[model samples]
Target: MDFEKLLVWQRAKALTVSVYKEMAACPDLVFKSQITRSALSIPSNIAEGMERFTARDKCRFLRIAKASCGELRTQLMIGSEIAYVAEPLAAVWIIETRELSKMLNGLINRISD
Candidate 1:
């Protein structure tokens, strides 16, 4: 399957773009970088995983991408708590992250099956 055609990849890419735009004006460089990097990892890992020849390798990549999603969610939560990102925006991101995680889980299951 084409990586771009995957809904999860599309969502991850959109979320990454959103994170970049929202974090653009953040005064805290470290927090901004942390959030953006993890956000970027989701789609990148997904793409890399899809390129793998074996199901095990693909699942491994998806797992890594899912881990990155968790990392991004944690960063966003911290950002919200610390006021780097507003609660509403963080909430949206959190939900988006959750959805992406679910999609990853489903894909992993399909691959395993």
Candidate 2:
């Protein structure tokens, strides 16, 4: 299966772009870099896994992507708590990222089984 064509990959790519745009607006370099990297990891891992030769390898990467999604969600929560991010904006990102994580987990489970 082509990772480029996967819905998980598409959502993750969009999330990464959104993270970059959001981070660009922030004044703090530390949080910006961290969040952006976490966001990028979601899709990057999926793409890297897709290039692997086995379904097991793909599942491993998908799990990593899901973990990154969780990490991104936590960062968003922290950003909102500290006022680095607006509540509504963080809410939107959290919802999307959480949903994507769930989707990735499902895919991984199905493939592994």
Candidate 3:
């Protein structure tokens, strides 16, 4: 399957774009870089994993992408808690990450089967 055609990839891409927009005003270099890195990892890893010749390798990368989703969720929470991103904005990101994670889990399960 083309990773770009997957719903999870689309959602993750949207989430990453939102993350980038939210971080635009953040003056802290460390947080900005960390959040952006995690955000980009979600889709990049997915694409990289999908190109692999083995399902196991693809699953491994999907798991990593899922982990990155969780990390992004945590960072979004932290940003909201620290008054960087608004609560509503953080909530949107949280929902997006959760959805992406769910899709990744489904894909991994299918590969395992």
Candidate 4:
């Protein structure tokens, strides 16, 4: 199966792009870098896991991706609360992250079974 064709991966790629754009002008370099990396991790982990030869390895990476989703959600919330991220954008991102997490859970279960 090709990871690129995955809906979750596609959404993750979009999320990563959105995050990069959102943080392009952020004065807090550290925050911007961290969030973007977390955003990037979603799709990267998905692809890496999909490419793996074993179910165990795939699940491991998927779990990592799911964890990264939690990290990203927290960062986005903090960014929104601090007014660093616009409310509307943050809202969409938060929704997307949650959805991605759900999708990842489903994928992980499907793979493990």
Candidate 5:
């Protein structure tokens, strides 16, 4: 299956793009770098996982993607608290991360079975 065809991958990709666009003007270089990295990791890992030959390898990458979702969510929460990110936008991104994590979990279970 192509990673691009997966809804989870598509959503993750969108989320990454949103993060990049919204944080483009952020002054906190360190925080922006960390947040963007976490956001980017989600779809990147999904793509890598889908390209893997074995279920174990695929699941490993999916797990990494899921963890990235958590990392991104945490960063967004911090960004909101610190005024780096707007509260409304941060809330939306946080929800997206949760949804992506759930999607990744479902995909992992399906691939494992």
Candidate 6:
């Protein structure tokens, strides 16, 4: 199964792009760097996991991606509170992170079984 064929991977890739674009002009270098890294980790991990030879390896990377979703969500929240991110955009990204997390969970369970 190619990671590109997965809807979750597609969504995560899109979200990462959005995050990069949104943070491109951010004045807070530290926050922007951290948030963007978290965003990038999601799809990256998914792709890596899907390419793994074993189910255990796949699950490990998927779990990392899921955790990255949570990390991204937290960063988004902080970005919104600190005015680094617009409230509406942050809300949307946060929702995406939650959905991505759930999707990763489902994928993990399916792979585990």
Instruction: Give the TM-scores of the predictions, in the order they appear.
Output: 0.98, 0.96, 0.97, 0.98, 0.99, 0.99
Please say which candidate is ahead in TM-score: 2 or 4: 4
lDDT of 2 by residue, 5-108 (tens): 99989999998998898789889999999999999999999999888898889888988999999999999999999999889999999999989988998888
lDDT of 2: 0.92
C-alpha lDDT score of every prediction, in listed order: 0.95, 0.92, 0.92, 0.96, 0.97, 0.97
Predicted candidate 1 versus true structure: per-residue lDDT over 1-113, tens digit per residue: 99999999999999999999999999999888888999999999999999999999999999999999899999989999999999999999999999999999999999979
The alpha-carbon RMSD values of the candidates against the true structure, listed in the order shown, are 0.6, 0.9, 0.7, 0.6, 0.4, 0.4
- The true-versus-predicted C-alpha distance at residue 101 of model 4, in Å, is 0.2
**Residue-level lDDT for 52 in candidate 2:** 88
Candidate 6 lDDT, 64-104, residue by residue in tens: 99999999999999989989999999999999999999999
Q: Which stretches of candidate 1 lie over 4 Å from their true place?
A: none
* Model 6 lowest lDDT segment of ten: 27-36
Pairs of colliding residues, candidate 6: none
Better of 4 and 6 by lDDT: 6
Off by over 4 Å in 6: none
Candidate 3 vs candidate 4: the TM-score winner is 4
The lDDT, on a scale of 0 to 1, for candidate 1 is 0.95
Q: Candidate 3 lDDT, tens digit per residue, 6-105? A: 8888888888888898798899989999999999999999998899989999999999999999999999899999988899989988998998899999
lDDT per residue (tens digit) for residues 1-113 in model 4:
89999999999999999899979999999999999999999999999999999999999999999999999999999999999999899999999999999999999999999
In candidate 2, stretches whose alpha carbon ends up further than 4 angstroms from where it belongs are none
Worst 10 residues of 5 by lDDT: 96-105
Ranking by lDDT: 6, 5, 4, 1, 2, 3
Error in Å for residue 27 of model 3: 0.6
